[model samples]
Target: MTTLELHGLRVRRGGRDVVHGIDLTVNEGEVTALLGANGAGKSSTVLGVAGLERDTAGSVTVDGTPIRGLAPNRVRRAGVATMQEGHRVFGDISVADNLRIAALLLPSPARSGAVEEVLALFPELETLADRPAGSLSGGQQQMLALATALAARPRFLVIDEMSLGLAPLVVARLVPALRQVAESGVGVLLIEQFTQVALELATRVTVLAQGLVTLEAPASELRAHPERLTAAYRLTA
Candidate 1:
C-alpha cells in the first residue's frame, strides 16, 4: 500500500538544516495531511520529495525506485507531482495552453483527452479554458493547479499551503477535489493552514515543529488529543 517513502531525509537551507532526519510514508489511496504552523518544515518535507531543492540527503523512493537524483520532470514522470503554493501557472497563457505546456510528456491525442479529464473534475474550468490564466480568481487558479497535476496522472501528489488565502466557500470547495482525487486511489500529501480542513480530510496526520516531526497519529486520535497537537506546535499559551 505504500506509494511514496522518505527515509532519514535531511534538507538544508543556507547551510542550516531545516528538515531534520524526517521520515514518513504516503500510502496508496489515502489522504495523509502534513500539518504545522508556518516554518514548520512542512513545505521542506514536500519539496524534498519533489526534488525541488538539491543538496538534500536522503532516500526518496517511488514504487521502490530511487528518486533522489532524478530531475523534476523525471520525478514527475515517475508519478510524483507537486502543486506548490500559489499555483504557479502561466499568467499570460490560456488555460488550455497552460495545460499543454505542462503535458510535455503526454502524447497529442491523450493531451486533449487528459485536459478534458481535468475539466470534468473541475467543471468551472471548462468555460474558462480559452481565457488567460491570470484572469481567473485565486480559487480558480488553485483548481487549475490541481487539475494540471491530475492531468499528469500522478500516483502521489505533494501539495503545499493549499488554503493560504481564500474565502471559506472556496476553501470548502477545494477539499472535495482532494477527496475526489484520493477516492480514485491516488495518495495525497497536503500541507494546509486551515487545521479544521486537515482535521476533516486526513485519514492520518503528522505534526511537524521546527523541522522535527513531533506527533503522528490517526486523524481521529489527533482530534481527541488536540492538546498534544497544540503543545507540539507551541500553542500552549
Candidate 2:
C-alpha cells in the first residue's frame, strides 16, 4: 500500500545537486521518519514529491502513476498533501478560512466534508476558527498547519518537522495527532530534529549522510542501536 514512491529521485538548485539518487517509499498506515542534518537533502527529496523542484531528474510515482513533471496542484489532487516546515499559514486570514483553502483544491462535495472532518478531529481549531491565524501561539500555529493539511483528506500526509520551534509540551501534544493520522490510514513521511521523539513515533527511520541514504531500518532497531546509526552517518554523538 505504498501511496508514494521515489526511485533515484534527483533535484538540483542553483546548479548544484542537492538531492542525489534518493530512494524513498511511503506506505499507508505507517510513520516513516527521514532523519538528517541540515544539508542532508531531506527538503529537496520531499519537494520532488510535490513537484516544486523544477530541475528534478528521475522518477516519482503517486499510487503507481508517474508524476515527474506534474504541477503541485495535480500532485495534491492525486492524494498527497505536504505540511511544510515553519508552519507557513496565512497571517491575517481566519483559522477556518485557512483550512478552507486546502479543501478548496478538491471537488465541491469533498470540500465541505473534509473541512468538517478536520474541524471535528482537532477540537482546538474549532474554538479558534474565527481568530486570525497570525494571532495564535506557536503551538496553535503548528496545529493549524497540520489541521489545514488534514482537511485535504490526503492519502499521504507529508510532514516536514512536526516539532521544530516549539516548547516540550507542544511537541508532546503533536505526537498523538500524528499517531492518529497514521491510524486512520494516512501514510506519514515525517522529517524530525528530535531523534528520540522521532524514534518513538516512527515505524521506520531513513538516515541521510552527505545527501545519500546511509542507514535505514525500523525505528525500534535504530533506537536500540544509536551507536550504529551514528557510526553509519559519521555524526557527532
Candidate 3:
C-alpha cells in the first residue's frame, strides 16, 4: 500500500516559521483530515508535502522514498496529485479539454483511457463535456477540477479547502465522490476548515493551532468528544 509521511515538517515564509515541526501520515484506503485556524499553516504544510514550497525544511516520504526538496512536477510524477483551493479549472477551456490537459503527463496511448476513466467517476461531467468550464455551476466546476486530478491517476491526493464557498448541498454532493476515491485505495490528505465536513470524511484528524499540532485523534474520537475541536475552530472562526 502507498503511504505518505511527513516528519518534523517545518515551513518558513518571509523569514518567519509558519509551520513548526508537524508530523502527519496518510495510508492507502484512508482519508486523513488536516484542520487548522486561518494562518495556521495548513496550506504551507500540504504545499510543502507536495514539493510546491521549496524553502521547506523537513522530510516527506512516500512509501519510505524521500521526496522532500524535489520539484512539484517530479512529486506528481511520483504519484502525488494536489488540488489547490479555488477549484483551479481553466475557465476558457471546455470540460473535456481541461481533463485532457491533466492527462498530458501520461503516455499518448493512455491519455484517452485516462479521460474516460475520470469521466466515469464523475458522470455529471459527461453531460457537460463540450461546455466551457467557466459556464458550469460552482459545484460542477469543482467536480471538473477533481476530475482533472483523477484523470492523472495518482496514488496519493492532496486537496486543500475543497468546500470553500460551496453550498451545503453542493458540498454534500461532492463528499460521496471523495469517499469513493478513498475506498479505492488512494491515500488522501484533506485540508479543510469546516470541522463537520472534515470529520465526516476523514478516518483520522490532525488539528493545527498557531502553527503547531494541537490534536491528533481518530475521527470517531473527535466525533464523540466534539469539545476537543472547539479550541482549534475558535482560532479559525
Residue 62 error for model 2, in Å? 1.3
**Model 1: per-residue Cα lDDT over 37-115, one tens digit each:** 7888888877778888876897999889999767788899988999998768889999988877777667677887777
Of the candidates numbered 1 and 3, which has the greater lDDT value?
A: 3
Each model's backbone clash number: 0, 0, 0
Which lDDT tens digits does candidate 2 get at residues 1-237?
766888998889889888888888888999999988778888888787887877898888878899876888888888888888897899799998999998897788889889998887788989999999999999999999999888888899888888899999999988988899899999999998898888999898888877788888999998888886677666432
Where model 1 places Cα greater than 4 Å from the true spot, the runs are: 235-237
The residue pairs found clashing in candidate 1 are: none
Best lDDT among the predictions, by candidate number: 3
Estimate TM-scores for all models: 0.95, 0.95, 0.95
Displacement of residue 119 (Cα, Å) in model 2 is 1.8
Question: Model 3 misses residue 45 by how many Å?
Answer: 0.8
The lDDT-based order of candidates, best leading, equals: 3, 2, 1
For each candidate in the order shown, give its overall lDDT on alpha carbons.
Answer: 0.85, 0.86, 0.89
Question: Is 1 or 2 the stronger prediction by lDDT?
Answer: 2
